[model samples]
Target: MNETHSPAFQREQLLAQDAATSNFNYEEFRMQLQNRISHLEKRARQLQKAMWISAGVLILCFPAVLVIEGFRLTEIPWVLPLWSGIGMLSLFLAAVFSGIYSSRYRPLLKRAQYDLQLSMITELQAQVAEINRKLAER
Candidate 1:
Protein backbone atom coordinates (compact mmCIF):
# COMPACT_ATOMS: atom_id res chain seq x y z
CA MET A 1 0.00 0.00 0.00
CA ASN A 2 2.78 2.44 -0.84
CA GLU A 3 1.54 5.91 -1.88
CA THR A 4 3.82 5.91 -4.93
CA HIS A 5 2.37 2.70 -6.39
CA SER A 6 1.27 2.82 -10.02
CA PRO A 7 -2.42 3.22 -10.77
CA ALA A 8 -2.73 -0.38 -11.92
CA PHE A 9 -1.13 -1.63 -8.71
CA GLN A 10 -3.37 0.61 -6.69
CA ARG A 11 -6.40 -0.67 -8.55
CA GLU A 12 -5.28 -4.22 -7.86
CA GLN A 13 -4.84 -3.52 -4.21
CA LEU A 14 -8.21 -1.82 -4.09
CA LEU A 15 -9.75 -4.86 -5.70
CA ALA A 16 -8.13 -7.10 -3.14
CA GLN A 17 -9.39 -4.96 -0.26
CA ASP A 18 -12.88 -4.60 -1.71
CA ALA A 19 -13.34 -8.41 -1.76
CA ALA A 20 -13.40 -8.51 2.01
CA THR A 21 -16.04 -5.77 2.30
CA SER A 22 -18.44 -7.46 -0.22
CA ASN A 23 -20.14 -4.11 -0.62
CA PHE A 24 -19.71 -1.21 -3.06
CA ASN A 25 -20.67 2.34 -2.20
CA TYR A 26 -22.84 3.03 -5.24
CA GLU A 27 -24.63 5.97 -3.65
CA GLU A 28 -21.50 8.14 -3.78
CA PHE A 29 -21.05 7.50 -7.46
CA ARG A 30 -24.72 8.21 -8.15
CA MET A 31 -24.54 11.45 -6.20
CA GLN A 32 -21.49 12.58 -8.14
CA LEU A 33 -23.23 11.94 -11.45
CA GLN A 34 -26.33 13.77 -10.26
CA ASN A 35 -24.24 16.79 -9.30
CA ARG A 36 -22.57 16.85 -12.70
CA ILE A 37 -25.97 16.69 -14.41
CA SER A 38 -27.26 19.50 -12.26
CA HIS A 39 -24.26 21.67 -13.13
CA LEU A 40 -24.74 21.12 -16.86
CA GLU A 41 -28.46 21.88 -16.57
CA LYS A 42 -27.67 25.15 -14.79
CA ARG A 43 -25.22 26.08 -17.52
CA ALA A 44 -27.86 25.45 -20.19
CA ARG A 45 -30.32 27.65 -18.34
CA GLN A 46 -27.78 30.44 -18.08
CA LEU A 47 -27.02 30.22 -21.80
CA GLN A 48 -30.74 30.44 -22.62
CA LYS A 49 -31.18 33.43 -20.33
CA ALA A 50 -28.25 35.23 -21.94
CA MET A 51 -29.49 34.51 -25.46
CA TRP A 52 -32.96 35.84 -24.72
CA ILE A 53 -31.61 38.89 -22.87
CA SER A 54 -29.37 39.79 -25.81
CA ALA A 55 -32.17 39.33 -28.36
CA GLY A 56 -34.57 41.36 -26.25
CA VAL A 57 -32.05 44.19 -25.90
CA LEU A 58 -31.43 44.25 -29.64
CA ILE A 59 -35.18 44.25 -30.38
CA LEU A 60 -35.72 47.07 -27.91
CA CYS A 61 -33.04 49.17 -29.55
CA PHE A 62 -34.93 49.09 -32.87
CA PRO A 63 -37.95 50.95 -31.39
CA ALA A 64 -35.69 53.52 -29.78
CA VAL A 65 -34.12 54.24 -33.17
CA LEU A 66 -37.56 54.69 -34.72
CA VAL A 67 -38.50 57.18 -31.97
CA ILE A 68 -35.32 59.12 -32.65
CA GLU A 69 -36.18 59.31 -36.35
CA GLY A 70 -39.77 60.48 -35.74
CA PHE A 71 -38.98 64.01 -37.07
CA ARG A 72 -37.97 62.61 -40.49
CA LEU A 73 -41.16 60.47 -40.57
CA THR A 74 -43.32 63.63 -40.53
CA GLU A 75 -41.28 65.30 -43.29
CA ILE A 76 -41.42 62.11 -45.42
CA PRO A 77 -44.30 59.72 -44.66
CA TRP A 78 -42.41 56.90 -46.44
CA VAL A 79 -39.64 57.10 -43.81
CA LEU A 80 -41.99 55.62 -41.20
CA PRO A 81 -42.72 52.38 -43.05
CA LEU A 82 -39.11 52.05 -44.15
CA TRP A 83 -37.77 52.37 -40.64
CA SER A 84 -40.47 50.11 -39.24
CA GLY A 85 -39.70 47.48 -41.84
CA ILE A 86 -35.98 47.66 -41.10
CA GLY A 87 -36.65 47.36 -37.35
CA MET A 88 -38.87 44.33 -37.83
CA LEU A 89 -36.34 42.72 -40.13
CA SER A 90 -33.58 43.23 -37.59
CA LEU A 91 -35.72 41.69 -34.83
CA PHE A 92 -36.51 38.69 -37.01
CA LEU A 93 -32.83 38.21 -37.83
CA ALA A 94 -31.90 38.42 -34.15
CA ALA A 95 -34.45 35.80 -33.24
CA VAL A 96 -33.23 33.50 -36.01
CA PHE A 97 -29.57 33.88 -35.00
CA SER A 98 -30.29 33.28 -31.32
CA GLY A 99 -32.40 30.25 -32.09
CA ILE A 100 -29.66 28.78 -34.26
CA TYR A 101 -26.97 29.51 -31.70
CA SER A 102 -28.97 27.96 -28.86
CA SER A 103 -29.83 24.92 -30.94
CA ARG A 104 -26.18 24.36 -31.80
CA TYR A 105 -24.85 24.53 -28.23
CA ARG A 106 -27.75 22.58 -26.75
CA PRO A 107 -26.74 19.35 -28.48
CA LEU A 108 -23.14 19.81 -27.45
CA LEU A 109 -24.19 20.43 -23.86
CA LYS A 110 -26.38 17.37 -23.92
CA ARG A 111 -23.54 15.29 -25.31
CA ALA A 112 -21.30 16.44 -22.50
CA GLN A 113 -23.93 15.36 -19.98
CA TYR A 114 -24.24 12.00 -21.68
CA ASP A 115 -20.49 11.54 -21.67
CA LEU A 116 -20.35 12.27 -17.97
CA GLN A 117 -22.93 9.62 -17.27
CA LEU A 118 -21.09 7.15 -19.46
CA SER A 119 -17.85 7.79 -17.61
CA MET A 120 -19.53 7.13 -14.26
CA ILE A 121 -20.97 3.90 -15.56
CA THR A 122 -17.59 2.83 -16.88
CA GLU A 123 -16.00 3.51 -13.50
CA LEU A 124 -18.70 1.50 -11.77
CA GLN A 125 -18.07 -1.40 -14.10
CA ALA A 126 -14.35 -1.27 -13.36
CA GLN A 127 -15.06 -1.36 -9.65
CA VAL A 128 -17.37 -4.31 -10.11
CA ALA A 129 -14.77 -6.18 -12.11
CA GLU A 130 -12.18 -5.53 -9.42
CA ILE A 131 -14.54 -6.79 -6.75
CA ASN A 132 -15.29 -9.93 -8.71
CA ARG A 133 -11.61 -10.59 -9.28
CA LYS A 134 -10.91 -10.31 -5.58
CA LEU A 135 -13.72 -12.72 -4.81
CA ALA A 136 -12.33 -15.16 -7.32
CA GLU A 137 -8.91 -14.92 -5.68
CA ARG A 138 -10.46 -16.11 -2.40
Candidate 2:
Protein backbone atom coordinates (compact mmCIF):
# COMPACT_ATOMS: atom_id res chain seq x y z
CA MET A 1 0.00 0.00 0.00
CA ASN A 2 1.35 3.47 -0.97
CA GLU A 3 0.99 6.29 1.56
CA THR A 4 -0.06 9.70 0.19
CA HIS A 5 1.66 12.84 1.53
CA SER A 6 -0.64 15.67 2.54
CA PRO A 7 -0.57 19.08 0.75
CA ALA A 8 0.75 20.75 3.90
CA PHE A 9 3.62 18.25 4.02
CA GLN A 10 4.57 19.02 0.41
CA ARG A 11 4.45 22.74 1.08
CA GLU A 12 6.66 22.31 4.11
CA GLN A 13 9.15 20.27 2.02
CA LEU A 14 9.23 22.94 -0.65
CA LEU A 15 9.77 25.63 1.93
CA ALA A 16 12.63 23.62 3.41
CA GLN A 17 14.25 23.31 -0.02
CA ASP A 18 13.93 27.03 -0.67
CA ALA A 19 15.34 27.79 2.77
CA ALA A 20 18.34 25.61 2.08
CA THR A 21 19.01 27.47 -1.14
CA SER A 22 18.44 30.98 0.24
CA ASN A 23 21.74 32.74 0.93
CA PHE A 24 22.69 36.40 0.88
CA ASN A 25 25.08 37.41 -1.86
CA TYR A 26 27.24 39.74 0.20
CA GLU A 27 29.79 40.43 -2.53
CA GLU A 28 27.19 41.95 -4.84
CA PHE A 29 25.78 44.07 -2.03
CA ARG A 30 29.23 45.27 -1.01
CA MET A 31 30.12 46.21 -4.57
CA GLN A 32 26.96 48.27 -4.90
CA LEU A 33 27.73 50.07 -1.63
CA GLN A 34 31.28 50.79 -2.76
CA ASN A 35 30.04 52.21 -6.03
CA ARG A 36 27.76 54.62 -4.19
CA ILE A 37 30.55 55.63 -1.82
CA SER A 38 32.89 56.32 -4.73
CA HIS A 39 30.28 58.50 -6.43
CA LEU A 40 29.82 60.58 -3.28
CA GLU A 41 33.58 60.94 -2.92
CA LYS A 42 33.92 62.11 -6.50
CA ARG A 43 31.19 64.71 -6.00
CA ALA A 44 32.89 65.97 -2.83
CA ARG A 45 36.20 66.29 -4.69
CA GLN A 46 34.55 68.27 -7.49
CA LEU A 47 32.94 70.69 -5.03
CA GLN A 48 36.25 71.25 -3.25
CA LYS A 49 38.11 71.80 -6.52
CA ALA A 50 35.52 74.29 -7.72
CA MET A 51 35.70 76.24 -4.47
CA TRP A 52 39.50 76.44 -4.61
CA ILE A 53 39.51 77.42 -8.28
CA SER A 54 37.05 80.24 -7.67
CA ALA A 55 39.09 81.54 -4.74
CA GLY A 56 42.32 81.34 -6.77
CA VAL A 57 40.82 83.24 -9.69
CA LEU A 58 39.59 86.00 -7.41
CA ILE A 59 43.00 86.32 -5.77
CA LEU A 60 44.84 86.37 -9.12
CA CYS A 61 42.51 89.00 -10.61
CA PHE A 62 43.07 91.40 -7.70
CA PRO A 63 46.74 92.01 -8.60
CA ALA A 64 45.99 92.20 -12.30
CA VAL A 65 43.47 94.97 -11.73
CA LEU A 66 46.01 96.98 -9.75
CA VAL A 67 48.75 96.55 -12.38
CA ILE A 68 46.63 97.39 -15.43
CA GLU A 69 44.85 100.42 -13.99
CA GLY A 70 47.80 101.81 -11.95
CA PHE A 71 45.19 103.02 -9.48
CA ARG A 72 46.16 104.10 -5.97
CA LEU A 73 43.89 104.44 -2.95
CA THR A 74 45.36 107.90 -2.00
CA GLU A 75 44.87 109.32 -5.50
CA ILE A 76 41.49 107.94 -6.64
CA PRO A 77 40.07 107.68 -3.09
CA TRP A 78 37.85 104.78 -4.25
CA VAL A 79 40.12 102.48 -6.28
CA LEU A 80 41.90 101.17 -3.20
CA PRO A 81 43.60 97.81 -2.49
CA LEU A 82 41.70 97.62 0.81
CA TRP A 83 38.37 96.87 -0.88
CA SER A 84 39.99 94.28 -3.16
CA GLY A 85 41.79 92.80 -0.21
CA ILE A 86 38.53 92.49 1.69
CA GLY A 87 36.84 90.85 -1.28
CA MET A 88 39.70 88.38 -1.65
CA LEU A 89 39.61 87.70 2.06
CA SER A 90 35.87 86.99 1.81
CA LEU A 91 36.45 84.51 -1.00
CA PHE A 92 39.23 82.81 0.92
CA LEU A 93 37.02 82.57 3.96
CA ALA A 94 34.19 81.08 1.92
CA ALA A 95 36.51 78.44 0.49
CA VAL A 96 37.85 77.58 3.94
CA PHE A 97 34.34 77.31 5.38
CA SER A 98 33.20 75.09 2.52
CA GLY A 99 36.17 72.78 2.99
CA ILE A 100 35.45 72.52 6.70
CA TYR A 101 31.79 71.75 6.11
CA SER A 102 32.62 69.08 3.57
CA SER A 103 35.15 67.51 5.90
CA ARG A 104 32.63 67.46 8.72
CA TYR A 105 29.97 65.75 6.59
CA ARG A 106 32.31 63.06 5.22
CA PRO A 107 32.23 61.03 8.41
CA LEU A 108 28.48 61.33 8.63
CA LEU A 109 28.15 60.02 5.10
CA LYS A 110 30.40 57.10 5.93
CA ARG A 111 28.40 56.34 9.03
CA ALA A 112 25.13 56.38 7.07
CA GLN A 113 26.59 54.03 4.50
CA TYR A 114 27.83 51.72 7.22
CA ASP A 115 24.41 51.71 8.85
CA LEU A 116 22.79 50.73 5.58
CA GLN A 117 25.20 47.82 5.22
CA LEU A 118 24.56 46.74 8.79
CA SER A 119 20.82 46.81 8.27
CA MET A 120 21.14 44.68 5.16
CA ILE A 121 23.28 42.20 7.04
CA THR A 122 20.74 42.00 9.82
CA GLU A 123 17.96 41.31 7.30
CA LEU A 124 20.01 38.57 5.66
CA GLN A 125 20.70 37.00 9.02
CA ALA A 126 17.01 36.99 9.79
CA GLN A 127 16.24 35.31 6.49
CA VAL A 128 18.92 32.72 7.16
CA ALA A 129 17.46 31.98 10.58
CA GLU A 130 14.01 31.56 9.14
CA ILE A 131 15.31 29.21 6.50
CA ASN A 132 17.21 27.22 9.05
CA ARG A 133 14.13 26.88 11.21
CA LYS A 134 12.06 25.65 8.28
CA LEU A 135 14.69 23.09 7.35
CA ALA A 136 14.97 21.91 10.94
CA GLU A 137 11.29 21.04 11.00
CA ARG A 138 11.94 18.24 8.51
Pairs of residues clashing in candidate 2: none
Supply candidate 1's per-residue lDDT for 76.
74
Clashes of each: 0, 0
TM-score of each candidate structure, all chains considered together: 0.39, 0.39
Off by over 4 Å in 2: 1-22, 71-93, 96-101, 104-138
**lDDT per residue (tens digit) for residues 1-138 in model 1:** 666598988877777787644466678879998998888777767766666765676577667666757655547767657656766766776676567657755674556577789999999999999999999999
lDDT of 2 at 82: 59
- What is the lDDT of every predicted structure here? 0.72, 0.70
Residue by residue across 12-51, what tens digits does model 2's lDDT show? 7776687434566768889999999898777766666666
Worst 10 residues of 1 by lDDT: 103-112
**Top lDDT prediction, candidate number:** 1
